[model samples]
Target: MADPLLVVPVREGTATVSLRLFRTATGDRTAVAFSSPLALARVLGPGQRWIRLSAPALRHMVADLGVTGIVLDPAGTLPPRSPATGHDVHRLRVA
Candidate 1:
């Protein structure tokens, strides 16, 4: 399995922080900084104060913040795939 994807963004003055959980075009989930692609582009596409990090790095950053397990896999949450398509796709969790 590959590592979870992550993005980190920091806002000015007010100390705004946003973390987005994303599943790649593939079926794995990653915690990114922006909630959506447009959001990320807004922050990163422009000159913003932020740094991208991997899942492990993110876990380390919040290790001391009393965060427990953050699961990303959608094994039992969604409906099973059809044998006809045979594609391994994980559904995104829409809020």
Candidate 2:
């Protein structure tokens, strides 16, 4: 709570960034944040963009949207990928 958390922002139609919200298994809206930038990249991948925000500020911002839960430092939803590894390299052909 003391340290500012790394937050992922989403721009829907407009350039203004808004806190990215997630859906719980039970259909509830929750906000997600990471304790540090490294933690964020570990979960959302290195190229993922983010913003810094305090816990209180994050909660307040989400509360307006009826999101009452915050998930902090959650584990990666998927494995992290890096271009340096070239594991994601692929080829495409024109039709």
Q: Which candidate number would show the highest TM-score if scored against the true structure?
A: 2
Q: Which residue ranges in model 2 land beyond 4 Å of their true spot?
A: 1-14, 78-95
lDDT of 1 at 8: 61
The candidate that wins on lDDT is 2
lDDT tens digits by residue: candidate 2, 1-95: 37555565432325665555665556567777777778777766777667888777887787778775777776635433344652421111111
Candidates' TM-scores? 0.34, 0.65
By summed lDDT, which 10 consecutive residues of candidate 2 come out lowest?
A: 86-95
Question: How many clashes (backbone N, Cα, C below 3 Å) per candidate?
Answer: 2, 0
**Least well predicted 10-residue stretch by lDDT in candidate 1:** 72-81
How large an RMSD does model 2 have?
Answer: 10.7
Model 1, 9-94: lDDT tens digits are 43433565544333444445544344344454543354434556666777776566444434432222233434476332334443
